[model samples]
Target: MLTGLKTVSKKQKDQFEKEGYLIIKGLFSKQEIAEIDQTFMEMSKKTIKGCFEPIMDQSSEVEDPLKRYPRMMHPHRVNDVAMKYMLHPKVMLILSDLFNENALAAQSMFYFKPPLARGQALHQDNFYLKVEPGTCIAAWTAVDKADLENGTLLVVPKTNNDEIYCPELADSKESFTNQYVKVPKGLKAVPAIMNQGDVLFFNGNLIHGSYRNKTKDRFRKAFICHYAGESTTKISGFYSPLFREDGSKVEPELNPDSGPCGNEFDTVYPH
Candidate 1:
């Protein structure tokens, strides 16, 4: 517990318990945000060319250039400044409280929304994470101001407790159905408007995704840190590309039936 530091109040905790997510305003300082952004910009300039290099390349068949770069993983090895941000005190405190134990880093991603970017499909983080329900949380910190104009995050309230619905592929265009935990009938989707230094702590089970960035000049960048409880287990069949001390890849046993039906189980960590 950080003494004298403003923490998530009990009332806020109640809101998170009821809504499945909480947005903490101004958790990082401008200096910290700048440092993290600088690191991302530098890493983005590097040309990756190996079994794991594609993790940073965004060039995609999609028209949107933002979608060109896939999520970047295992950045701690590439950027020390980003590693500092990943283990920030404020972020760790909140994770400790929510998980009721010391949390360990499971993954990190840099979602760069260049102009005219296509938004990600709405889905539960666990759909990709493959962790046990309620045992993981994603801490998303914005390196730039996130708002509706630039395609900020939109989340469905109170959906974390619902049964882990079968995840649809990113290409599915259907609206919410029985198989999907649709946004509440009457409540409108809320865009999380955050400053550069703000952080949104969301349950892995929460139904959320971002909109496409429509602005031609402004870019939306977010650094997400995924943390899990100490006892968390890796899903079988999914092999995380994270490198070990000897630079060898560790392939976890995968569940024969895991993954999106016939799609391959793509690991998002250790990139």
Candidate 2:
């Protein structure tokens, strides 16, 4: 085990149990944040022309004249520094607890929220992940300061265990469809504001999304990691590239040699 792993105290764990999410402040150092930001900016500048226009039209309703220029999906494998942060020890500790053992990285994404960008539709991670309930998590780390002005994430309290609900899709050309988790009647959701280097860990079933960035110049950059427990199984119609411990792709099928899945790790977590 890595020394000085950021363990979640009882209070923090309780908060997560109640709200379906928790924020760890300053999980990354300022120097680390700066390096990631620099890497992102450089990559953004290089890929900007080829990416921006198409993604904007697909993911948001912002018109060309009103949209803020933003970048999406920087490949992490291309950057060693990014890959290090993705597998950081502190992160792995929390994930191990959630998954009740060693976990595998299911997906990684880099989201850059520039000024005037529209908020993402409120939805759960499992909507796209298609994994068993409570078997996955999303670790969202801020490379730059995130707040209301810069499109910080907003989440409904205590809504994780509920069955998923379909959200009203805003008129957009986005490729992925969004379905929000149902919120209880008369309850208001809260916005989660995070400073640079902070990481927000939430259940894959949590209902969350961000508000549009209304700030003039600030940019909110977040690196997100999605991980699944050893017992996690694939849902039909949703696909993820499964990998073994050595990172080689596993063949599609369930068998003794196919690795663990379908409640195999139910007792792995120590109560």
Candidate 3:
């Protein structure tokens, strides 16, 4: 058995190790969540070049709501609010316990799963990160109420030990991303319903994704960040310039040249 948590309950740590994921309730206070909401809501109106490029024409109709407001990648590189929360002390503490060492932040993403938009297909994080020996972990914070109807995250429990499988083409009608990892027989997808301020931390190899948003009024927004343990030696170049918990940066050895997501192409899923 592993040592108990430092700041979390033994049950929480046990669940994370056994199920490969844990949901920490109200990890951020109301005021903090409000600030995060306000910051990203305002950012949604503008684009930040390489970090976030949204369709400026609000009236230009497109079939995909993602085209109007695509997911913001690496917002911490451009926005202080994003950076502040990305290295949140409480999150860092939990991560330290999980990794049994310091946690290094790799990437931050703001997903605006607007109403009628598609969800990301089920996939493994290591397939993209390619962390050597050890793997990455994710802290997914919900900025809005997320539920099954709105297409919140769906995780397949006990799959964290599975190898990264070759992804198949996803159905474009439902998934925003093109690649998908098929669910093994005998396992089931469980909805990870989260309120604003709640965070779900999961292993890199977890089989997880979401379905298309069917809600007409509610939008599921999330701030997700990836991290590698202190013991990690190499990772994908795309996640270069990792960060320490104190807002400082660290550069790890880059993984050997290879396909972006374990596939034959270097093309990454824009979602």
Q: Global lDDT of each model?
A: 0.64, 0.63, 0.84
TM-score of every candidate relative to the true structure: 0.77, 0.77, 0.92
The ten-residue window of minimal lDDT in model 3 covers 258-267
Write the residue-wise lDDT of candidate 1 on 3-100 in tens digits. 65556788888888788889999888898888888877777766543211433344462443633554465475466665566666688778777777
Q: List clashing residue pairs in candidate 3.
A: none
Better of 2 and 3 by TM-score: 3
lDDT of 3 by residue, 67-120 (tens): 787788889989999998888888888998888889999889898898888888
Residue 239 C-alpha lDDT in model 1: 25
lDDT of model 1 at position 73: 53
Global lDDT for candidate 1?
0.64
Candidate 3, residue 200: Cα displacement in angstroms equals 0.2
What is the C-alpha local distance difference test score of candidate 2? 0.63
The runs of at least 3 residues in candidate 3 whose Cα sits more than 4 Å from the true structure, single-residue gaps closed, are: 1-6, 59-62, 257-271
Q: Pull out the clashing pairs in model 2.
A: 58-174
Using lDDT, give the best candidate's number: 3
